[model samples]
Target: MSAQSTATERRRIAISALARELDGSNPASSAARLSEMLDTPRQMIVSADIDGLVSAAMLASVAPSWNVVGLVASSSKWLLHPSVSNEPPAGLVAVDLFSLNHDSISNHVVKYGAKRPMLLNLRAEWQAWDAAVAVAAQKRLFAVPSIWAGTQGCYDDAAKADSSKWKYPLGTAQILLALLEAADRPPKFFDRHYLPWLVANCDGGVSTYTKYAANARVWWAVMAGAVGPASLTEQVFRLVDGMRPHDFLDTVNALDRERQASGLDPWLNDDWNLANSQATTIERCLRWLADLTGWRDPLLGGIDSFAGWVEKPVKASGAVYIGGANVTTKSTEAAAVASLQGARSALNANFYHGGFSGSRFNWIGGW
Candidate 1:
């Protein structure tokens, strides 16, 4: 295949593996779940193209029983495999596709003699949110997606009835506030795009999954001493310094090996619990080691600053902020301009005082 095709396949494999890891489900188990739910022989349908093969492989990673059938481009139909010709597959699962199109998707049930077809919308939901806002703002923009929780749903019903009402650990806001406050100028996307998105998302009216995860990652990152680029650079060094601790180094190496073995992207894209735990443990261990070695935070008492920032609601101009810059759109609902843009301007003023340089550090996507 072509180089681009190979790279795309690799990325697809990594994302499927990452999804399994995040949901704590293996292919056999996920297939078993589907089998129990649908009681059908799972077969994944795809076009005979290279991208279709990648999708088939990703689906097979999640649904082990899934047999792949490539629909021929010339005929617009699949050549029925001999093995299951008589009985036929029960259900066809479509992967890496969102919209309903193509004969492989549109005619799968009739063509394949399947009961129903399932679409594994594995693409991150924040993509939808960003697209929505981009359309609203009339701009061509891409958003950095989140890895803070399970990617299945828009919101965890058990966690909170309304997404807007969710509460975060204290001092979470302080980290972001600190980053914005520390910047030499307004962040590139702050005034024009990001600020507006943040205000609209955090208002709690919509079930924007990545918004919460983004907030959590930032909170944990700050707690782990990554307030901004300066500290982020330092945090990397500290993580490397962790090599001296045999236990921690071994665990890190083990995780690295696991990802390599599973053909997953060696990045923090799975399990927010693990990410949070590792950050918390690493910070504590590093702090203890620093005390012994006469190392101290040059920025000073970041944890304290975090605590101070989230202690009370912050106000500037007409906007009020709480729980890590999440604003309540409830009070501002009546006045659209005053509520959205006003809050956006206020946030811009708060976070964009100093100038910023370079791109935002998207943990998963990278800068």
Candidate 2:
């Protein structure tokens, strides 16, 4: 099928799943359901383009009705705007902070307390944080907590005690969100400092790591576009060539040995043993460096080639005549080619085929 057709089919599948979820159907009904629903795996769907769906008027929320036994009603229109290409989506709600400021609940109970009102308020803030997360998820936006705000259990010990005493980090989610909202257009580029800061601070899981890495690349590409290729070349070189080749190779070999001793396939257990994300990223940086410098570096080229081999299958099929030299023999190469093609087709049918290099070609070597 053509790329456009494939994308259209994917969009249809995604929207249909959203519709079913709105209809109060569970997403775990079957394998097809899992494939269609964005939220099934939770992790993968969390960072999907939820804003696009909302803009398309495809999302709705079900709220409990006033009558206890009555069915829930759909209320609250959900809409989202992508502030930055790299930042998570934010929700907008117009509340009268002025009214709350003079209210009995805010003045008597919240502001001035005879007992530990701060703790109570903090608890309420925590609840609000949870609600915000839910809203963000419903909109299919990234739900990143403030680094210093203590949401999702990410905060310093002292800051967690009192909401009023919340401390802010430089690269906190709030800052990023604000930047995203302030920008007139999607932020495709970011400073080098921001990239490392994000990587070092981001929480790790497959989705979190993937998003962070993707954003970093986006920033790199943007910077390269603005300043010219020379600066990007330096940055890419620093990232890839800074590491010692011996150290990386030794680490991979050691891991392989350990996996062999444990009777486990290193490729399955530890992706780095194969052409994993780390290896792929490193190779990509090297290739970008080569392109920038216009010089063929052996180390970078070698690693790039090795990574490709690891990512792609090595297929060798040729017939050998078993009859004596005096007798003529015929071998069928067409059968071998057909068999290989069939296997390739089967692999393409599976999700996430062709390994990291194939899927992430831009990052790997093609630039």
Best by lDDT: 1
Model 2 — TM-score against the truth? Answer: 0.18
> Per-residue lDDT for 1-367 in model 2, tens only?
2323333333333334322322213443221221233222111001111111111111111111100000000111111121211221222111100011110000000121111212343334334434533443444322121211122222212322321112111112212222222221112223342232222222221222234332233222332233233433224323432444354344446645755786743232232311222434334433432343232332312433433322222122212111123111124334423332332211011111123232100000000
Instruction: Give the per-residue lDDT of model 1 (tens digit) for 1-367.
Output: 2323333333343344323321213323222223232234454433333223323332333333445432222112233344433332433343211111111111010000111112212122223323333342222111001111112112222233212112221121122222222232112221321122221222121122234443233323333342344543224323332324353334436545755787744332222111221323323322322332232321112322212211111222332221123322344333422332333211111111112331110100000
- The segments of candidate 1 whose C-alpha lies over 4 angstroms from its true place after superposition are 1-40, 70-77, 82-90, 96-367
| RMSD value for candidate 1 | 25.2
TM-score of each: 0.20, 0.18
> Per-residue error at 116 for model 2, in Å?
11
> Roughly what TM-score does model 1 have, to 2 decimal places?
0.20
